[model samples]
Target: MSGRWWLLPGTLCTAEVFEPLLGALAVSPQQCRSVRLDRPAVEDYAAELASVEDEDIVLGFSLGAILAAHHLDRMRALAAVLIAANPFADTPEKSAARLEQLARISVEGPGAVMAAAWPALVGPDARENPAVGNRIVAMAEQTVQDLPAQTELALRRPGAEPMLASARSRALFITGREDPAAPPDRAMRAAAIGRHELVLVDGAGHFLPLEAPRACAEAIRAFLLGRGQDRS
Candidate 1:
C-alpha cells in the first residue's frame, strides 16, 4: 500500500485548476497530494474531507466527482478511482435532471453558472488556448460565489450510480470529447458501474484537468500503473 496521489478539485475549482495536473503529476514517483473542496456542500463540503486517507490515489474532478463518490467508502485505502469530468446515475430521469441542474445553478449565478459552464468546459484545442481558456475561466471566476451553494449540496447527494454500484475500487472514467458537462453519455453510465476504465480526452472538454493537463496526467499515470502503483 504505497501509493499516495490525491489532487481533487472541480466545481468552481481552486488549487489553481490543478495546475496542469499538478505539473504533470510532478513527474510522478508517487506522493502527490493537492486537495481542495472549499465548499460545495456535500455535508458541509465533505465534512472537511474527513482526514483523507485510506491508500489514497483519489484524483476526482467536477464537483470533485460528487465528493469522490461519497468519501470513497470512508477513504478505505483506495488504490484507484480517477473520475474526471464527473457525473453518474443512469436514470431516475438522470437523477431528476441532476436535481434540476442544481436548482438552476443555485438561482442563476456562479457567474451565470460559470458563463453557462464555459461552452461545456473547453476543447477545440482548449478553446484555442487563450492561455488555456483564460486559465480555466480564472478558475471559474475564482470559485464563482461558491458554485451555486456548492451545487446545491451536490444536487442533494447520493447518485454516483448507486454509489458506485458494487464498487471494488480500481475505477477510472475520465472524459472530455466535447464534454457538455459530464458528457460521453456521462462517461458511459459511469463505466457501467464499478470495475471501470474509460478515458476520452480526444479534443477535451469539461475541464479535463484544465483542458488536458498532459492528457490528464497521462491518464492518471496509466491509472496508477494499472493499479500496481509502486512505480519503482
Candidate 2:
C-alpha cells in the first residue's frame, strides 16, 4: 500500500526545513525523498515536476504547495498530495498584491522582510530558542532577496486552482491555527474542489512541520492512509 513520497519545501526554504517530517516518515513502509525547487516561475516549476512521476505522494509546504497545485498535472500517477500552510487563492488581486510586496522585499532587502515575516512564520519559541531563531533568520535573510522576483514571476503565471479543481488526486490541506500567513479560511477555499481534506493544529504556527513535527507527521500519515483506503 505504501510507495515513494516527495517532500517539497516552502518558499525560501531548503530541504532542511522538512528534516523533522522526513525523519519521522522514514520509518514508514514508503520510500521517503525530498525535492528542492529553486526560485523559479510556477510554470517552470511545474515543468520540473513533469519528470517526477510514479511517486505515491507529494507533500508540498507553503509556496511549494502552490507549485504542487500548479503542477498537479505532472503527478498524474501519484496517490495524493499534501499541501501545507499555503495561501491558496484564485483571485488576481491577491496574486498581484503578493507579487508587489515580494518586489518590495527584493528592493528593500531580506532583513526587512525577515523582520516582518519571522514573527508571522514562527512562534515565540523562535525568540526563546536563540539558536533555531538565528539559523532560520540567517537563511531567510539570504533567501529573501530572491523571493520578490521569484514570487512576482509566479504571480504572473497562471494559478493552479483550476488545475487542482479538475485533478482526481486527493488533496489534503494542513494549516496551523496560529499561522497568520496562511489562515484556515484560505486553506479551506483553496481545496474547495476535488476531494479536499483539512486538518488544523491548535497551537502550531505556520512552520508546523518544524515547530510541531511529530503532530504534523502523524496527520500526514493518517491522511495518506485514509486516502489510500478510499481508493481501495
Task: For each of the candidates, give the backbone clash count.
Answer: 3, 0
Candidate number achieving the greatest TM-score relative to the actual structure = 2
Model 1 lDDT per residue over 1-232, tens place: 3656666677667756766776776735346676656554556645545655666666777777657776554555464445454554334665576567556766775456655556546778766666765665577667666655665556566566655675546667777778776778666666767646777778877777777788767767677676422121
**Cα RMSD to native, each candidate?**
15.4, 4.2
TM-score of 1: 0.30
After superposing candidate 2 on the true structure, give the runs of residues whose Cα lies further than 4 Å from its correct spot. Answer: 27-35, 80-83, 87-112, 124-127, 141-145, 227-232
TM-scores for the candidates: 0.30, 0.78
Best by lDDT: 2
Off by over 4 Å in 1: 1-8, 20-22, 25-59, 67-141, 153-155, 159-163, 166-219, 222-224, 227-232
Question: What local lDDT does model 1 show for residue 205?
Answer: 73
